[model samples]
Target: MNIKFSPVPVEDRERGRNGNCYNPGSPLTEGMKKQFMEEIKPICIEMERKYGVPAAFLGGQAVNESGFGLTRTGYFANNFCGLKFVGAWGRKPPQIMNGQDFGVETYQLIGQPDEAWDGSVRIIENLGEDRLIFDESSRYDNRYFKFKSKPEFFDFLCRITYLNGSEGRLYPKDLRYIFDEYRQNIQRGMSIRESCSLVACQLGKSGYCHTEEGNGTPPQRRCNYYSRVITEAMDEWNTYEWTKIALTQN
Candidate 1:
């Protein structure tokens, strides 16, 4: 699989409001988005193998979160999926890269702390004793997890954000019904885009697909909005002939 990274054009970046480059409401052209997806195709395949999350879903997420790698975090920090750094979890702290302070915004976990795939807690229990300092505002500097490389960012994104046992475990129990229903549609030769979109909608309804904790009442409206955006983005990638071939080969 040929892999290539295409930076968003300077003019396109300038078109966005403020100093930011990409605007979600007015995203990049379809051709540009397709090129971006093509470049990340191999990473998506690797993630699917390691995490069990479908590659199509991963690609769709990249599109949804970063606007095809045009957002400030995506273009500058290489942080896709809008994954924020809660704590180091024994890893190095987020560093400054390309003038972006990776550790700037502090996040309070919505619910009980969950363990990641590696057994590290997402929200560190002890902040003061954990070698972390408060920012100027006297707040913890737990901002976005910036990556020096795309692969590293994606790996962390999948391992920490998506592989939590809450949602991950739900896959076999709560999510199985939806998956089983879609299994037939997929096996029946439904188009990948359609199948992905339908599954996304169902996942939204289940309310188990969010990256954050505190799964309560399903946010039908928000989830459906996310599904629509993700589905449309995945559908865009599906338009590429190579997507079908690549998906099959994977």
Candidate 2:
């Protein structure tokens, strides 16, 4: 069962009529959802191979965090996991921009006049960072890491998501314990969906934002909601045609 991987279509990657990758007001279509899953499947597979994290779990998190890559942080910053840039791993803290701290330059491909002066050429530039001041979406605050590519984003996501507790705030004791529990579940031969549900519950209990509630929901409710959503997503992906084929190979 060989699954052919493909890049996201240029139109899907480009800014929509509202000047972002997909209009915020518009509902995400089935096509968009399928495209997002196709684009991320390879990256999730690679992360699973490297980190022992289940690909279904990673895919579910990406779906939950990014709204299937429709959110500003997910699409513009390539940060599918809702990771905040806290100057961890000795990285320099991002500079403030437009009254917002933790600013990172974000790049997007746009059509510009070609060198020949005849036709427009697609060039990647830091246009997204410039748009932050005017964009009213609270999620577009420029406070997340900006990656040049999806692979780079997923690699960093894996590191922080499964970090040990040597660092204080960035990799806290509870997060480390969550990672250990996930590993233990895997070692115990738990199904990916089951393991992801348990980890999602742990994340909710540890005050992680697995959904967009943003401290509005009660901890117990949030835990149940996050776990349910994650488990549902894993179940869907486990049955998806490509994912089923990919899992056969695995």
Candidate 3:
């Protein structure tokens, strides 16, 4: 008998809220917990479908240090891994903003006169537009912290962050456990279909496109490959086409 695939999607548990593992002093909240799982899970899945870093691992790390994202500094800094800034022009880093800025820009769809324009400008101005505002915000840091290649990143996450019932060495053994778990789940006929359409829909809804280096180079062709994933996935799911053109102009 063929076992049916269940795309019920196992959401990562919120450590601070659901498990109560986080300290009471932790800022972890029920609302943020809900948002994190609801929002990040799909993102993780899309990333995993393309990059192979198990969604669980990314979710686990965010839950681990950030108290499921309740840490004030974590929330403010977007420093999900507690990764430090080692780069220099070398001197003791200033305490005022010594973290990676996620560079989360804000905007509004309203025409001409708008409140968001002022808000967005004020935020950029207040921060002095220095860039390097947070540790995880930098694509360079994100690439460094994550695996060198997408495959390496996937393997590393499985070992270092995810997996149940272990917490000693953060590599090799940890990765082994996580990989085994993935195998077990897969053998059980887990849905391995890689569809980027859902990701495209989400990203489209949010009105953003991620560039290869985040240097604002008009999004590379390879990066736009994600759009293909979305298109194909949508075609498979409901026989619908997201874009009228076969592919966007290069």
**Candidate closest to the true structure, highest lDDT:** 2
Name the regions of candidate 3 deviating beyond 4 angstroms.
1-27, 87-250
Ranking by TM-score: 2, 1, 3
Residues 1-250 of candidate 3 have per-residue lDDT tens digits of 2212111111111211211211223344577566755554554555455434445434544454455444332443344443323221122223212323532221111111111121322121112222212222212221213223233333433333333224223221223333444445545755332222333323323323333344333433433544454454333332212111111110
lDDT of 1 by residue, 1-250 (tens): 3222332222232221222223332346778776877788887777655654556866887877887777666766787765545343323322321123433332221222232233333332223222221122212222445678778877765564545433222122235455456547756988767776776776666554453323454577546766787888777666323335444665
Window of ten residues with lowest summed lDDT in model 3: 107-116
Q: Which window of ten consecutive residues has the lowest lDDT sum in model 1? A: 130-139
For each predicted model, how many residue pairs clash, with residues at least 3 apart or on different chains? 0, 0, 12
Q: Which ten residues in a row have the lowest lDDT in candidate 2?
A: 111-120
Q: What lDDT is obtained when candidate 3 is compared to the true structure?
A: 0.33
lDDT of 3 at 9: 10
lDDT of candidate 2 over 24-57, digit per residue (tens): 2136778878988888888877766666555677
lDDT measured at residue 1 in model 3 versus the true structure, 0 to 100: 20
TM-score of each: 0.53, 0.61, 0.30
lDDT of each: 0.53, 0.56, 0.33
How close to the true structure is residue 172 of candidate 2, measured as C-alpha lDDT?
41
Error of 3 at 27 (Å): 4.9
